[model samples]
Target: MQKNALKNIIYSIVLLLLVFLVYLYRKDQPITSDNPDSDVFKMVVSGQTMGTSYRIVYLDPSGRDFKQQIDSLLEVFNQSLSTYIPDSEISRFNKGDSLVYESKFFFPILAKSKEVYTNTDGAFDPTVGPLVNVWGFGPGGASLEDSVSIPDLLRQVGLEKVEFDSVQVRKNTPGIYLDFSAIAKGYGVDVVGRFLESKEIEHFLVEIGGELMAKGSNENGELWRVGISKPDEEGAANELFGIIALNAKGLATSGNYRNFYIVDGKKYSHTISPFTGYPVVHGLLGATVVADDCMTADAYATAMMVMGTEKSIALQKEVEGLEIFLIFSDENGMIKSYVSEGLKPYLSYAEQNKPSLDQ
Candidate 1:
């Protein structure tokens, strides 16, 4: 009887110890990894890319050095996308290679380009390269001449002239060159953003040239803030039109004021109309677009420039996931502005219309 009692007591003791261990395990569960407050340290990385500069800020408590890896990755990225490089996939394709080929980066950019191309009604044609060259903005472009043939170039500038699938890319017509410059910088920003993410860095801001992609929060544990430049030609440097609180968003700006020429009392912008076969001449001074991805934002920004003020505004109203701000001149050349309803919360101030160009 005593032996039986001792066995029962031992079993009970073992059961209690097991219960205590499980309780201890439950108490030791970790906090959520998605918490934004834990990543306070930031590592900044910058380099030249796509004929422009790139900047990346990411969180890393390990102090890991990714500069070499980043440089190498960007170098290969340039090789795949840069038209300036004669041997690049894009360059070779432009030179008349018919194969789509496999690439981690080129295909995604091309797919996004096609998506924007379709949605924008050819307003964002990458095949406008031939026209871009004629306007003195692209490789082998000449100085603006009084007389230049445009109708001939229009024949080659349609996005429909090119076709691509997962395994193949073919141009329906000869001389249909593709130029992704409008969206490539934004894609570069995304590339860097993905690189940071792959390294398990959760909080990051990536900017290449003027395009940007932001994820999570900053060191302040607040949303990442990005500034849009005022369209003021006479204002001080770094003057902001307004600040945008960016969280898991991509931003891009397309402006005629930045890359245009005044010749013989006529202004010629780099943005060309595929339908008109000429540089866009419209009331739009600039367009800022926010999208789910930087590539879409960049392409839409350029497309909106081609669509002009009214069309773009209409587009903003109908699009489900786009936010935009437009700075344009009215019929009297008076400066005005339009802001999407979704973008109002992001603006730092009231963002009323510009006083006047004279101001």
Candidate 2:
């Protein structure tokens, strides 16, 4: 009888071990559906970075939380690109330290800035930092209208004043400053999106400030939808001018409607013209651009804001795979918009406001 009991105990131990192994296997396995038996889930992570809030939504089959990893990635990006950090790589470059070869983040953005600068004929120049400061839109909030000369500032406002390659960047002019504020947010979105893709996450949306990138379908298995805000004053009620369905694309918008100042009955927009060294005064209130990447969309949106409506429309025709939606005022102060042929199928106007559409 004692021998029989010993054999039974051994059999129980082996069964328990087998059960534990099965549990471990199931825990590591990924489920691809939202059914009760499946583990696939939608995860949302949000935080503040680059002086603005960011939100990331992704469908994870493993049901893992990635908030901590996402935060770390954004912190590293800011250390390389954020001017507000004062000791960041870009800040150091602005403060006369020209050689920044250590950062993995700096070179890619620098290269993109050069491309846009050349393509836009200096309209998308990052070397316009001095003009941005004097216009009270930069970190230096005080407008130096009384002490600074526009012509003197214009000398320091061109990408040709800076030279850079993949390894190192050198400033040709001592006073030249590089500010990637216009494109950095979009690049931030791209950075987070790439991180998700690296982890084998197929469906995701990454948004920083107003710039965003979308890939694959959303939680409901439909194309991701985004809204463009109406061009209104800073204190006015926030509303959407239109909605767009984005499919593996990036979208960014630039407008002076919210961030402008009136001095002596003249409105000064925050978007400074690189060539003129002055805030652009034009009827174009907003420019929205969509591209394959958020960084390209962001830079082109800013360039379009400076280029005005007609020039921007012409540019859209010249560049392939670029879709633009331009909002401007007519001679009688009526709001009118021009939507590129590619964007018309994906765009729809809001109920209360429908401006005359021009293709």
Candidate 3:
């Protein structure tokens, strides 16, 4: 009887050891869905890039975490495009290095900027950097006295003065500077989305700052939903004006409500118009655009803020596959919105506070 009890104790020890080993193995494995119908696993990777945060959610059958690779890719992108980086390709070009032939990133954005500049009639100009600086919005602090130089700065604020092709970029005017802040974040979103696609990730959403690109359905097999924030002051409570479902598309929002300064009871917006060389004063408080790509969406959103409500509506009608949702003040000072027909099908709002559609 004693011998029999000893053998049973030994067997119990071996079984417990096997159970512990299995537990450790499963603990190291990637998280998978509990649902038996779905074989793919969901993974999220987030990090900082381009002076902002980025989040990527992807459904991978292989359950691979791509944080390291994504961070490395963003570093390479910054080396090519980030103006804040002292020795970046764009910074070097802005400092009068006329030939940036090695950068594959700069040319495409320059080409896109030129296209948008032409289409917006120069409303979306990357060459407005000097004006931004003098207005206290850029690296240079507020020099209200330097406002006298607005006309001279305007001379340097046209994309037509800059020339570039697939190989190299050259500036016709030495003072002409390019600041892609308006569109770079959206391009970063596109870059990550393309990277995921290259890795055979069919279902993913990539967001940089507030701009985003969505492809396929989310892990729950539903279209990705994005929220638009209400046009409120900087310190106000976070609130959503509406939400929209997106698939295989990009969305971007631009608003002057948060980034502005008040001096002597007069408000100054961060959005300096390329035409007037001053902050735009308009009823349009926010502009959200949906387009085939995030870069186009971002640039057009900024342009719409400068164009105001009517011109933005007109432009949206002219451009195919372009949709806009604009928040503005009506003639009676009441808050209102204008939603394009294509965008309306995807957007939803609270019934109690539904914005009167200007349509």
Candidate 1 pairs with clashing backbones: 100-169
Q: After superposition, how far is residue 126 of candidate 1 from its true place, in Å?
A: 0.2
TM-score of each: 0.84, 0.87, 0.88
Q: Over the stretch 253-347, how does candidate 3's per-residue lDDT look in tens digits?
A: 88777666666667778789999999999899889899989999999998998999999999999988789988898888877888999988898
What candidate 2 gets wrong by more than 4 Å, as runs, is 1-39, 234-238
Q: After TM-score superposition, what is the CA distance of residue 273 in candidate 3 from its true location, in Å?
A: 0.3
- Local accuracy by lDDT, each model: 0.73, 0.78, 0.78
Write the number of the candidate with greater TM-score, choosing between 2 and 3. 3
Better of 2 and 3 by lDDT: 2
Reference-based lDDT, residue 247, model 2: 84
- Model 1 Cα lDDT, one tens digit per residue, 16-134: 11101000111112222356565344567767777666667766766566778888988998888888899888888998848567467877888898888888888998999888877
lDDT of 1 at 239: 56
Candidate 1 vs candidate 3, TM-score winner? 3
Query: How would you order the candidates by TM-score, starting with the best?
Result: 3, 2, 1
